[model samples]
Target: MIGEARRALPLRTATSRLVVVVRAASAADYEPVLDVLVDAGIRSLELTLTTPGTIERLGSLIERYGADADVGVGTVVDREQLSRTIDAGAHYIVTPITSAELIEQSVTHGVPIIPGGLTPTELFASWSRGASAVKVFPASQVTPGYVKDLRGPFPGIQVVPSGGIDIDGAAEWLEAGAAAVSVGGPLLGDALRGGDLRALRARALRFVTACSQAPRAHRSAVPTRP
Candidate 1:
């Protein structure tokens, strides 16, 4: 089945845009998180495999939302997980680290993959393998300026800062050249532990609006030296 999907479709031809990844903990958590994201106008959502009943929940979400949303699975670590995620109808795959086999599998299955990387070498390696985008995991340790510096040499790399991203910091990352930023705790908040869904939705809307309004950095014109 996986082999057939690979032969039938490919990831490169997938949609071209930054995606929002929601890494929640439980199946119950997904509903509120998704409602918040959807209300905020975010069309893409990713439910990490570790989340309980993720596959079943994803199926339910697909049935409910239909084409109104784009759903995927995240935290994929091995072939088995990859196969399952694909079979669950994930629109894309996201991992916390680079894996050649995973990238190959995603490409074959025709689902875009966003593999995480922390250094220049890892980032380039992931890109070379056809990752839809490279996630700079634990991005708080590295400022947005670092992304700008990276783009200096690797101009077309689509970088998405995953860990430690929040509404306050998302704009800076985007201006620094990140294709998109995946925010978790801030957006989800303590709501996971029984907080208000309305509050979560409101917060999600604010974050999305902020990200949308963030200004892209200006590219400098290079001087030709004689």
Candidate 2:
């Protein structure tokens, strides 16, 4: 499985230490948006299925930039979408919530799955199920401080903080403990609405540079007492 060859920590799969979440009005946005980000040296892209014509767009992107870019699908909520993403050659799959069935399907299909969660219990549940990584979602609800705290209990778990991550916040999350940061509107803004490619490219560069400086968390765990 080409996608299965990623590192144990999902975020480590990205050279930029950033997963740029792209949401667009339609399939027409895939090429330009992804091209700008990839050319800027950000290889990880999560194209949310919420966009129209995602199947075709995902396939096309995989055929075109799949060699250089780590292209995947986001907002996958059900098994059906999971199957479709795999068949389309998605490098990975991300869901807003942790679903055992989704995880199982990803396992069955041999693709990686990043499930979303809020509480410690939810996050742990996802991790225990073989998720590629756990996404602490709506990150606005918790600060980077929370990620540091989570380390105390779940030291070995790979985490990616998503939702509402701003330009200046990527380093904050990385420094605190995020394996990578997922950014959407804060990075793309109007460019996703057909605004400007060059500006989006610049923003992608800024984020890549920001994440590059933050120290990465190693995969380790607190050993249990025998």
Q: How well does each candidate superpose onto the true structure, as a TM-score?
A: 0.84, 0.90
Residue 13 in model 2: shift from native, Å? 3.3
Scored by CA lDDT, what does every candidate get?
Answer: 0.72, 0.79
Across 1-226, the per-residue lDDT of candidate 2 in tens digits comes to: 3223322533335456799888888978778788888888877888898999887777878888777778879999988888888998988888999788888778666677789999999987877777777899989899988776777887767788998998788898888878788999888878867788888888888888888988876657522111
Q: After superposition on all CA atoms, how large is the RMSD of candidate 2?
A: 4.4
Candidate 1 per-residue lDDT over residues 63-114, each given as its tens digit: 7654656676789999998998888888778898889889888877667788
Candidate number of the best TM-score: 2
Model 2 stretches with alpha carbons more than 4 Å out: 1-12, 218-226
- 103 in model 2: Cα distance from truth in Å? 0.7
> Highest lDDT: which candidate?
2
lDDT of 1 at 132: 69
